[model samples]
Target chain A: MKPFPAVLKEKKRYVIFEIISEKRVKEDAVKKAFFREIKSFIGINGMADAAPTVVYFDEKSKKGVLKVDNRALKQVEQALSLIREISFNKCFVHIIKTTGTVKKAKELVKRGD
Target chain B: MKAFIDFVASEDCVSFGKKLGFSRLLFNELSRDKISKTKINIISPKSPEESKRQLRNKMIDIILDPFDKRGLFIDSAFLNIAKQKQISIGISFSKFLRADENSRIRLLHNMRRLTALVSKLKGDLVLMSLAAEIYEMRSPEQLILFGEMLGLSRAQATWCITESPKGIIRRKSL
Candidate 1:
């Protein structure tokens, strides 16, 4: 198959979220919970299509940006919202903003911190 | 602009919520003595009868978790009474947070049913974080998203998080 043109590429969204917990959260645990929650919410097929990825995470600030297909935005948001515990500590994921570009999402995270 | 309110279990959470951008805070326990000192008070009834009694009293600002135990506590008849008395019904997101997988699904289904009922009756519905700690608090947008997932429209969800709580605060002051 020919390489798809840039215009034909799948549209993506970046979600900026912060983890507020009693203990600092590690990136690996965030990734684990992220996939687990998304899988549980939408199942394996949906996970394959959603193709969510943790593009950026700062353990010190406990802020991160996730890249997901535009079609899966709601599913990803719902999954993130439903996450109550991470690494045995009660936590809350507060989604700050969603943008089409990574730059804008990163800016929002910086301003939030 | 919108004002956010959370019904908290502990007195210590009041100030913590204030720091987290909550304009107003309500304590969930029903001690008349403590009510006077707090920003707001929520009357958590033990049974349907107690809920009915509290709804009639103008002093009682909110009916928190009326249907948490089991079965339908707020039926159409009770909703009409609440509407006539200008009383608001509250649903706590904390319950959903603490529920396990099976229970979470059931809770969501119940919430959707209750939200539909409240909308049909034109009764006031408030969505509270009911956070006991700072970490448990949710942003306004997150609350609205949660509301939407439970079958409420975006505008309705926004109202639950903003206008409904404001109305409760207004009535409390008046």
Candidate 2:
């Protein structure tokens, strides 16, 4: 038999998760939890997509930058300020950004945190 | 054996030093007196694994109060150790560890960069030591976790000594 070539395989992926945040992200602990989970996936060299995603603040089409940080616990403070009320009449909106594998996107969507 | 002294005692790190027979110097005295910030330094560990472990343990404390009314609490003992060791002080000092959003934002940004660095390392953990001369400060907990999230083990673990000049050290050390 001719030389057998061994091919190694690893599942690498990039996924962007956008959430209409069922509730305005005003809880620091909740946001911290969200990012903390993200942290686990961030540095995996293989079988993972480690890239920084841009957080876009969208209201009335006015956009600014939001940093995803463990310190952004004040998101609750800010969310509390902006949330006049939350009711179950409308759909939560989110746009998954340009990225990688479908499996990654599914993983992000499955994250209830 | 010679002993090291810390003038700032933002936390029990000084007491820990005392237990070790390194003279307990409260950092508050130096910071309160408006002492020179440049007096101390540290020699850090070459292993990233150690720094990461310290960062993980201390970060639990830092994130406890990332932004609070009391602001960050810092101890000079960590700084003095860095100085005594003659090590290069790397990242993890807040230029202004304060409650203000502007300062906190910068601190958060730097913290992100640090965590990113930690994520990249090949070591089991990355370690770091910080030195702050102490001024009006911010949440010490945030400072601790920010380092922790980035893989700093213990801010003082790497160094063997911290130097505090006599008379300036602190009465609390007594």
Candidate 3:
């Protein structure tokens, strides 16, 4: 099997966001809530376009890195911004920054500590 | 760098707004004699008629949200008057963020209408957190993104957080 060429491949973006919540949210709960909101907002087809994944998340820092399709970056952001709560606890997810690489996104998240 | 201004519902989010990088945070309290000692004045009228009355008052830096208590009262006439008065039409992000799924749909419908009219009239539309709690406070970029979601162009959305609010602050001088 051969992978697609760079031009044919979907360009990716890393979004670093911090969840400001009253209590520490488990990574699983965060992932669940995140995908649910994205799916609900953008729908299945849009989710496929986004191709989002939680690449890294720190429970203590409440910061996480999400990998998504570059073209659907704004759609992912809209979903994250509209997230008012997760696991029944009120919270707000603020995008610290978006970068082209996961390493850079992780570094930005680490610097927030 | 553009100075970002946000309007908050209570005194609690003031410290949080500072942490979020907002240069100014207007505390919207009806009974406040001078807005806040440090913050600018903001008014949220209960009805379109009341909004018309508040537009005459020079003390108000921004007409926080033009809603008739339970419903939005924004129309071309209201926006034109607001434009003439130099009073920025504020759209609080928390209002939509706080609504349930059913009401959120209705709210979005109304907000889109407001956005189209404001853009058509070239009115000053200020987007604020108006967060009652610390967690409710969103970053300036997030507010700008939310503005874009509300049927505003990217540049127009950026203006809501940057130039629009700055104009109100400059006029009020606080």
| lDDT (Cα atoms) of all candidates against the true structure | 0.81, 0.31, 0.82
Q: Between which residue pairs do clashes occur in model 1?
A: none
RMSD values, in order shown: 2.9, 16.9, 2.8
lDDT per residue for candidate 1 within A4-110, as digits (tens), equals 99989999999998888889889999999998888988889999889999999989889999999999898789888888888888888888778999998888777
Candidate of highest DockQ: 3
Q: What TM value does the first chain of each candidate achieve?
A: 0.91, 0.26, 0.93
In angstroms, the error of model 1 at A106 is 3.9
**What's the TM-score of each model vs. the native?**
0.86, 0.23, 0.88
For each candidate, report its DockQ versus the true two-chain complex.
0.72, 0.02, 0.78
Model 3 misses residue B154 by how many Å?
2.4
Residue-level lDDT tens digits of model 2 in A2-113? 6545443332333233333334443333334333334432324311233223343333222212233323322321221111112322111122332245454444444431
Q: TM-score of the second chain in each model?
A: 0.82, 0.28, 0.84
lDDT of 1 at A100: 94
Q: Which candidate model has the greater lDDT, 1 or 3? A: 3
Cα lDDT tens digits for candidate 3, B34-141: 554355667777777787787777666677657632667767787787788787777888888888767777777777777788889998888888888888788888
Off by over 4 Å in 2: A1-113, B1-86, B90-96, B114-144, B150-174
lDDT: which is higher, 1 or 2?
1
Candidate 3 chain B, run of 10 with poorest lDDT: B30-39
lDDT of 3 by residue, A1-113 (tens): 99999899879999988899989999999999999989977899999889999999999999999999999999899989889888999998978888998888888888883
